[model samples]
Target: MDQRPAISASQAGDGVTLAASGNWTVTEAERLNGEIRQAARLPSGTRRVTIDLSGIDRFDTAGAWLIHRTARNMVNDGLEVVYTGIGPSREILIGEVEKSDRPPAEPRREAPFVTALVNDTGEAVIQSGRDLVQLSSLLGSTVLIMAGFLFRPWRMRLTSITYHLEYMGLRAVPIIALISFLIGGIVEQQGAYQLRYFGAEILSIDLAGILVLRELGVLLTSIMIAGRSGSAITAELGSMKMREEIDALRTLALDPVEVLIVPRLIALVIALPLLTFVANMSALAGAGLTAWIYIDVTPQTFLPYLQNAVALNTFLVGLIKAPFMALVIGMIACLEGMQVKGSAESLGRQTTAAVVKAIFMVIVLDGLFAMFFAAIDY
Candidate 1:
């Protein structure tokens, strides 16, 4: 029996006729959900939707969610969404999620361009001041956590941290390396194309070298971590918060900040820089390959050029930025996770906010570094 969900679109009375029939699992439900969306958006006089799930023998949360997202998207476009003939099992799941006590989020406020600018500038200054003030607190907290871990290594979730690193650090390297390598390759290739005409192909080495060190290496590494580790950190703390583990730690007279936050934050602060250093290496290696392929610069000649173009200070300045970036990612994630209220929804929101804030901080720090290095002629 062909059990895939049905997707048929046609013109019905006043709106549209979008119908689907299937049990949606996490894997296949999304595909059917997409079908529903396409049918609902059909250019017809149909003023409403009639989703049929009668063919669906059994369904779960995934099915309910598929209906909700599709329905919500339709509602946002001033249309309605409903099931024409929901089966008994599917109806129960949808009823629970749809009728659940979910309060609407607070309405957002908009500001004019000038007001937004002024507000942002003020907020930036205030946040910068707050960051400076909090740095000392972070240092003290980190030291205390390290002391506790050193004294009671068993108390430190060593396996948990290792498992996390295996996923976030080791598993992520290939993707980062691929992207960094391609970025380096593309930059050199483009420069070679342009410079070949001007007889400046050699300059491409210095250009890619400095740019990779100063910008792409740190920025891409941080961004990757924000997506990978930052999200994981937020999710970890968020799950703990959701399950009342954070509160339980309080009940046990343990400071969640020192016990939970510090270890993860410190680990990130250490790991990110090392990961970025590897990213820089891969980027330059790829650049060397591109130089060879595009401009006939062999590895032997290119290695010396890269060496000459890069100095200890050049690498050191970028390394100096990593701890700060890692701190931003870790702190923002932990802080946001800690602030999540009593709900799974709030945890997801804070997790997303953590990633976004970390990425933003990474970029801002990059700009600051550029100015600082340029001013100092480093």
Candidate 2:
């Protein structure tokens, strides 16, 4: 026999009485649903409803929810609703469903364009201030740690520093050299091409020499390191953080700032200046080669023109910026790493943020250095 649920309703005066029978489990849900709809279509003049469940043979949470929903809907339609024959257990279930039921959240209305723009701008300004404060805190911590290391050099993790140097510096040299070389070649070729219009192709050597020494070489090196090494630093530290290794270090009375971050920071501070010097050499070599091959300018003539074009301050300006940029990149990477939450998604997010923020800060530091040097006429 098909165990379908049934509903019978009777109308008297201005009241409707509904009797529910048979199984009201999910198997009979379709039938119960149809019966409920039919019972709801009472006489238009009806103002009260009473639902009786005494004849119901079976009931579940689903059936109870449906009953509760029907009663609530009747109340919403301006009818006085009454439910009867619900046992203690079924009544508790129904009560739970009623308590848990909530209307869907309303969609938010968007503000006007001008209002939204102003709001967003204010939020951005506030966020930038918070970021500046965090960065400054990290900087102060790093400086204090480094100063302490000077007194207790043995506390510095030499092995970790060497490993990071190999990971971040040695592995990075080829790409840095290749990119800087190509950039240098392109700049020289363009300079030669433009100079040819004025019959001054020899001036290409001077242009390439001055540009690479004062700006392009170290700048490109710092940007590359920020993207490459900074992301790796964040991923490593973030993974450790996510796995609670950083917390473990703290529990063991080991300072993570000194044990982990300081090594990487020292490696970057030492490595970046060396890498920048190598980049400068590679760039000059590429420029010289390009001038010889493309513009028929020989090494001998190029050397004389380069020496005459760039002063000692030009080389020092780029080299001096390398350590500061390195410090910024390393600090941002470590700061973001320490911010990672306990999830792979958080680790990935922090890693990406580290790279992006490090690169941005590196560029910003370069600009500030440029302005300061210009102000001092260095």
Best by lDDT: 2
- List model 2 lDDT by residue over 1-378, tens digit each: 444688889988999999888888887777777778878888989999989988888899879877888898889999999888978887888889998899878999999999999999999899779878998888888789888877988877899999888887888899999998999999999999999999999888888988898889988999899889998889889989989999999999998988888899989999999899989999999999999999887899888888889899999999999999998899889989999999998998888888888888887888898899999999
- Poorly placed runs, candidate 2 (over 4 Å): 1-28, 35-61, 77-79, 82-106, 342-352
Q: Write down the lDDT that model 1 would get.
A: 0.80
Where does model 1 exceed 4 Å of error? 1-140, 147-161
Over the stretch 1-378, how does candidate 1's per-residue lDDT look in tens digits?
Answer: 666665676666676656665556677875776676666565644457666666665567877787777777777777766777776766778878777637898898898999999999999999768755665576677777778887787877666566655766678788888888888898889888888899999999998998888788988999999998899888888899888999999999998886787767757776888888888988998999999998999999999988998888888877889989988888888777777788988988989988988899899988998899899999
TM-score for each of the candidates: 0.62, 0.82
How many clashing pairs per prediction, in order?
7, 0
